[model samples]
Target: MRFLAGLFALLAAFFPGAAPAQVVDGAVPGRAAAASVTDPENILVLDLSTGGRVRIWLRPDVAPKMVERVKTLARQRFYDGLAFHRVIDGFMAQGGDPKGDGTGGSPLPDLPAEFNYLPHVRGAVSAARAEAENSANSQFFIVFQPRFALDKKYTVFGRVIDGMQYVDAIERGEPPASPSRILRAYVLADNPPPYVAQPSLPLPAPASTLLPLPTGPAAATPKSAPSPKPVRRAARKATRR
Candidate 1:
């Protein structure tokens, strides 16, 4: 049985969150309900182009301001049709940039950093910012694997408790050639419309102009093209010494 044990270990390393848990119709089973969110206001729902819905339990206790920002944007329907602009396999999927080019945010003011003790485990939802910590605005990302090193570095405001399988299906690329999108976003308390599959539409070319960081936060350095070095470093830390 040594061979079988070794195979299982390999699988566990590659799919750390793949423990067999019951899922029904893309929702986590009731057994996880004890830890799952029930309060409608604390839940953020995304109807994704990858198909089906993703339910996130917002953590106001640790990151109240970030939670409030996300809820406010969702109520405005600001996230609908926004591309999953930056998706790295085995890392995370980032979107909510109106530019669809990793360089945009809502007209709303940038938020102060809400960094907390939350670990960046699989399905953790965190806000994305430029070099400046307090520059996070409408952009956010969802972790595909555990990334503990990012715990206190980014503002993690939520965790996905359901429909993660759909999240796993998001196309992988810095900007996916055919990027998945948020068809709709809702605060569960609002009684938003049911999920309806949207027809595929061509995304407009991204604009070259980058908006200056909002007035309150420290000036943000312009974001350069994404590099693989950070992902490589994170992988080595997770796998090697």
Candidate 2:
């Protein structure tokens, strides 16, 4: 239990938002939702193109920089129409790329890592960065499964307080064949502008781009073989004789 005590102290010092509650009679305390009942401003509303609505609660106490970055971008309408370019089924849904491919972000400079001890439990929201520790820009992901390995690695700044179903339903693929997108996103505290669905990117060419096959009976009928040239009448008569 000494290890647990030290771990709790470490977490409390750096991640006040996720300080583990004291275990009482083998039962854990209630969720943060119960504690956040009076603080609706911390919740963000994300509306997707498929008419799905998601509510996520920000945790500035644990990842102040990341939470601020996200709120800044959301208020500017930066995530509107951005595709979930990288989604792994049973794992996560990632987005915030302006390119709709996983390669773009806002013109703003990248943010320094704000790695925290927040647990990557299902519905946890964290920044998406490249190999470099401080490369996180506008991209972020929402986990659909517990990912303890990600703890203390990614910047966990929020958790989905509502609409996990929508997050679960987001299209899945490294780059989903038909990726879903954020129709609009806004911080509940910022008096976010009204959401307007953005146009979807042009679809890829069909798997088989071959021209449509000719239809109707005329196309089906094989032309009769050209009539054999009439054998010379003289040759025919000689053979008969």
Candidate 3:
């Protein structure tokens, strides 16, 4: 019993060149199928660290700067598996923490604020900030109401297209009593590039970076950072939106 809105239709639109869907209501396909996206309208296909998935619609016309920042961070897996450290019952739940605290953000530097005139309505995506204007990095929350006062002060970027019930179902608190894990967060290119580019980062040379010769003590283990596996960038199929 999930309530859906026009945002769902927007999702269908952003990812273009699609066939007609016999969608009933707005229940999206299962998460795994959702992960294997082929639509270009898809902006953020979240593989939440909690095993739940969410898809967000990016309005290039509305929050262009914000969308660019989000895509870069997502490609880097910046918010992966972080905790939603803050929640206000009846207000909204917040996450995107790397240290599992309200303060922790991405390894990258903070993003200058990009406040637009968008209203803070239900399912609205806006950046969370401290006392300053341009202090946002990787923190945002969805508004469940129209916060008019936040109109020009916060960057109202995107909106929840579907799976809001999942967002609503998350346990709430300044920090939940138990860890509110994100499980794994990742973004699939709504439109994957036609060809796989060689990994831009050069791989370490074979012998030096490879299996130790077993000659000296065990080689130091390198940190294994989880990365997003590249999928074919989806084309903008014909949309029902």
Candidate 3, which ten residues in sequence have the lowest lDDT sum? Answer: 232-241
> Which lDDT tens digits does candidate 3 get at residues 1-241?
1334465666668865443455554433431122212344445766543335666776555556566667777777676555566555555566665545444455566666677656767788777654456666667776655555566766776777766766776666545654344444444454433222121111111100110011222222221213322210100000000
lDDT of 2 by residue, 1-241 (tens): 9999899899899999997577775445662322252365677789876556788988876677777787888888888767776675656677777665545557787778888767878999988765456767787888877766666666888899887887888877656788788888887766655655555554222111010111342121111222323422211111110
Which of 2 and 3 is the better model by lDDT?
2
Q: Which candidate number maximizes lDDT?
A: 1
* Inter-residue clash pairs, candidate 2: none
- Residue 16 displacement (Å), model 3: 37
* lDDT by residue for model 1 (164-223), tens: 998999988756788898999999999988889997555544422221211222222332
Q: Which of candidates 1 and 3 reaches a greater lDDT?
A: 1
Where does model 3 exceed 4 Å of error?
A: 1-42, 49-51, 190-241
Candidates in order have lDDT scores of: 0.74, 0.65, 0.51
Once fitted onto the true fold, the runs of candidate 1 whose alpha carbons sit more than 4 angstroms away are 1-36, 206-241
Candidate 2 stretches with Cα past 4 Å from truth are 1-38, 191-241
